[model samples]
Target: MPMAAEEIEAMIRAAIPDAHVEITDLAGDGDHYAARVVSESFRGLPRPQQHRRVYDALGGRMGGVLHALQLTTATPDRGV
Candidate 1:
């Protein structure tokens, strides 16, 4: 079964309480998604690390229920 966009957003928000998360379903399929995550906690982190934080929020669901995620991460001032 594919994951719901709301479920993905909730998971990220749970991990990063202060984050602003936007999830989009690409190709009209729940398996393919694009997520924009902005958080103050990502201020000094590198791009890879920031992406990792969001991935970690998914709890290892990346290759299972969630197929593909095009992720964009940024800080408040950085903008999406």
Candidate 2:
């Protein structure tokens, strides 16, 4: 089954309570998505670590129900 953008956002929010998440459906298919996640928790993390946090929030759905995710993560202090 394909993942819904709402579900993705919910998962992220659940894990990172202070995050601001934006999810877009690219290719008009639920399988491909673009997510922009901003949180205070990411303030000191490297880019790779930031991405891993969001991926972890997905609960191992990255290559399964959620096929492709073009993720951009940032901290609110960075003006994202």
Candidate 3:
């Protein structure tokens, strides 16, 4: 099954309370998505680590509920 944008956003928010997340269904299918996230928690994290953190929030749902995710994580105006 595919995941909902709200669910994805909620997962991210749960992980990073201060994060601003925008989830989109890129393929018009719930499984494929793109998320642009801005968070204070990403302040000192690297790009790869930032992505991993978002994935971690999904809790292994990557290949199951979520098929593909194009993620962009940053900290306010600064890129993570």
Instruction: Give the local distance difference test score of model 1.
Output: 0.95
Clashes found in each candidate (C-alpha, N, C closer than 3 A) = 0, 0, 0
lDDT of 3 by residue, 11-30 (tens): 99999888889888999989
* Tens-place lDDT digits, model 2, residues 1-80: 89999999999999999999999999888999999999999988899999999999999999999999999998997746
lDDT of each: 0.95, 0.94, 0.89
Candidate 3 clashing pairs? none
Q: Between prediction 1 and prediction 2, which has the larger TM-score?
A: 1
TM-score of structure candidate 1:
0.97
What lDDT would candidate 3 get against the real structure?
0.89
Candidate 1 backbone collisions, by pair:
none
TM-score of each: 0.97, 0.96, 0.92
In candidate 1, what residue range of length 10 has the lowest lDDT sum?
Answer: 71-80
Error of 1 at 64 (Å): 1.0
Cα lDDT, model 1, residue 22: 91
By descending lDDT, how would the candidates be arranged? 1, 2, 3
lDDT measured at residue 60 in model 1 versus the true structure, 0 to 100 = 99
